[model samples]
Target: MTQTLPLPVTPLTAAQQTSLVNLVRRAAKTEILPRFRNLSAHQIDTKSGPQDLVTEADIAAEAMIARGILQLFPNATVIGEEAAAKDPSLRQKAAEAELAFIIDPVDGTWNFAHGLPLFGVILAATRYGRPVFGLLYDPMVDDWIIADDQSPTRIAGAGRAERPTSVSKPGALETLSGIMHYYLMPKDAQAKLAPVLPSFSRMGSMRCSCHEYRTLAQGGVDFNLSGILNPWDHAAGVLLCQQAGGVAKMLDGRDYNIAIEEGYILCAADQGTWDTLKTLLSPLYE
Candidate 1:
């Protein structure tokens, strides 16, 4: 087995922070936008299956982001969703690297490929396996929801002032609204959770973690449950959620890590909600 090195505890500089956000925007404008609703049949391909997709936009945007990162931080390890799909070993290296970047170029590839406007780009900087900086960029709106170790979660761009944001206050279970990716759960787990759906005020999956995290951080939603916990998918969102005064933990109640992939994750608006939701979902894991 390869040894995993501890992540450096250094924080990102002001210029590095700015460059990370710019990288996402550049990729979206130069690679993603032109391919939206304009993909040739040959430019798209299925990865795991029909529901799991990869397109010219995803590939091109990831390449663009990867290049930008290497240019700015030449020694940093860049692990992109598409590239990881092709080479699974890269994920392990990313998890162990002192300075690493995880990129989900097109987070909602299904929605994007189908011409839906719910897709977005995600970038996370980690030391070892812990997230230190996160950026969630929406191309259509040209805005970024960002967070770092030194700052609370905030939104910027589109000529608007950067404003701090937080998670919704905990409400009664009957009045709580959240997203759950039930379909991604195991059959037995899904069966166990089926009856728990109507307990929430609103329960639905947006098929996009980017939007779900945005909603949670902006106080638009109370909680989110993800059956699949890939680093590229959850790393940035989890950090942003935590920075915005929320709680994110694995089913076993461990802190979210970039190397984790098996356990489910529950990110809630507050600790009270997290405790309640964990108890509610305990049956599935039990």
Candidate 2:
């Protein structure tokens, strides 16, 4: 993710950035927190499977965040995961938009639904299909991890100070550790990836990309491999990883884009670690 980017002529201005981050915090405070453990059985529903959940909280928070984004950048296209799921065409629209804000109201919906405090809200501002700005907000802690194409990743919140962050030092593959998504991949792909797991020190899925990327950016994790390529899920985290001095790309060596339909996203601490992991994962794409 730390590869050089074709940066936009202008990233979000300081005023805009501050306002947008506040908007996300407001949504979490007003919409998400209220419904966290308060979600009634009737307020929750399934999308793809039993574990794939959407609560009233997700819907309300997305609406709030989306509306606020529109007010600030009236011409920018805003695509929320929940909305795009109801209308697939929106994904294409966001991908091609001159400026688009991709929103994941709750990145760990399953965890949130089950009363886990590990969920988060993610927002990515892309120019055309490339992420130009990214925000990963943890509602529980009321703080955020943020980055732009040209800035180092920073952690900040209401009264908290902001500080730059980076990834961990590279380590041997057997000494390296991180998260890998398995169950979500196709059965054949799962079989191909399973054998590769034991080669690393540790591998598991938190069912949440938000915290996974946050951990990687803060030097707590060496790498992250996710099975899906949804824009809302990876766009922000990809930029977060890049700004934190980590390498991020599709298994095939392509830099990430909102237009990518399917592939694993592999993010690692630095070029050497990324190259090694990429070579090991090359077979899946090959």
Candidate 3:
């Protein structure tokens, strides 16, 4: 028999946690907020697809956030969406790092670049590819939803007392509502999942996982499904959903890891909801 040792994981000190919150807020104010609705057409660019986008705000904010992270935790790995996009290898490196900070400087760039107020910043800390902590911050709202795996605790913002979060109670499928990224799926997967869309009462995407997860944590929505699997997009939200008394996993039954390259993720408020959704959506992924 072969023996394997568990990965060494360290909890973030109170100081580090507080520093991270401040750093993200400062980056958003200085680099992201200033550039909102002010970017030139040339300042925005596309990758992978026309619907996928990046902007000067994303670039600048990522630089700021990454730099700040390095300064605060010199030994930690920092991976930004822009840099990872440029060099695909960063993703795997982050997945293996003992401590890593994965950042989505400006989530929903398509929305951010188009003068929509739906985008936000996401920061996720992973230890050996598993999320240890997650933060979803909305620059527009000047608030955030933060969680960590140890206690599975979720907090809203500064000075706000930590409160237990619960997802919407399990309900009839026809009465449930959630965010679904239907257009992001492949054509064939879309074909298979289209018929099932109406099984739920309503399905829409805010185009931003930050807001989407925030809404789900607060029970504003019952669930969300994503055909695309980007660690920076889902890692934080996965922890938040889990800590908020919800269920999150790949539709194919695999747990989410930073290195996962392909798989659809379905997150819901509870196990019953998760099982129902997985049963309904499993065929599309398979």
Candidate 4:
């Protein structure tokens, strides 16, 4: 039985936007959830290079998401990781599309295969390259996190809400740097991070980008550090963070463009925290 999805309270009313997210969540739960356990082994492959990994579950999950989207919006283009890897031209089509679904069926394939419980299915509907609808589902936890610049929602075992309690802001990085992750920081840089803000705790890394951003939005984490960020990896979560009242940017405080292969990205609850981080990172990296 299909669940009754909540009504959209934001600018997006794309016929079945609510249902679409729910559909993806349900499909993820059905297909990927069962396989979370009882795994004998997983089939894997390399993409772009050996470090980037994809698995059978990732392919199957994206296909499931694509089929659900096409069934609802036949005209909308869908660009998925596995499919786009096989044919690069689809990426061009996605870039040009007025409406396209950008999807990474499993965001943390490494963790998923290892049964570390950090993998998820990520979907974002972009209008002319700007995300309008986004959903990230963790089948392991049975959690569905949804957000759009327009309408953002979280459905969890506890309950559902349009947004969390108002987002929080920390002092500038000069004072708050210790509370955030220092991506790709060298031992010298890492040591400096602690001394920069003796009052706060040093930052840590969550290998899964989606979870890191989610924690940032929820006020549980202060910043994200990633030397190499992927469009599919950060796209949905970035939109969600911005909508949830946080800010995301490159280390230089630049706009995030999905087309870019890598970014020294930072995610904070607000501008002040971002400014502090940017200032500290500037002289060091230079």
Q: Report, for every candidate in turn, its global Cα lDDT versus the true structure.
A: 0.90, 0.91, 0.87, 0.68
Local error of candidate 2 at 242, Å?
A: 0.6
Kindly list the per-residue Cα lDDT of model 2 for residues 1-286, writing each as its tens digit. Answer: 6889555643589789999999999999999999889988999999988988999999999999999999999999999999998999999999998899999999999999999999999999998889999999999999999999878899998798999999999899999999888888889988888788889988878888899899999999899988788988899899999989999988788889999898788999999999999888876887
Model 4 poorest 10 in a row by lDDT? 172-181
Check candidate 2 and list the clashing pairs: 1-242, 1-247, 1-248
lDDT of 4 by residue, 56-120 (tens): 77878888888988887789888988888898777667766777888888777767767788877
Which candidate number would show the highest lDDT if scored against the true structure? 2
Which stretch of 10 consecutive residues in model 2 shows the poorest summed lDDT?
A: 5-14
Q: In candidate 3, what are the lDDT values of residues 1-286, reduced to their tens digit?
A: 8989764354787678778889999999999999998989899999887888989899999999999999988999999999999998999999999899999999989899989999999999999888988889989878788877865646566567766666788898888899988888788888898889889888888888888998998888999988778899999999889888899988888888888888788899889889988888877856
Residue-level error in angstroms, candidate 3, position 244: 0.4
Provide the TM-score for each candidate, comma-separated. Answer: 0.96, 0.96, 0.94, 0.80
Residue-by-residue lDDT tens digits, candidate 1, 81-193: 99999999999999999889999999999999999999999999998888889899999999999998768999999789999999998789999998999888889988999
lDDT for position 78 in model 3: 91
The regions of model 3 sitting more than 4 angstroms off are 1-10, 158-162
In terms of lDDT, model 2 sits at: 0.91
Q: What TM-score does prediction 3 earn?
A: 0.94
> Model 4, stretches more than 4 Å misplaced?
1-11, 48-51, 152-166, 172-200, 283-285
Each model's RMSD to truth, in Å? 3.0, 2.9, 1.9, 7.2
For all candidates, the clash counts are 1, 3, 0, 1
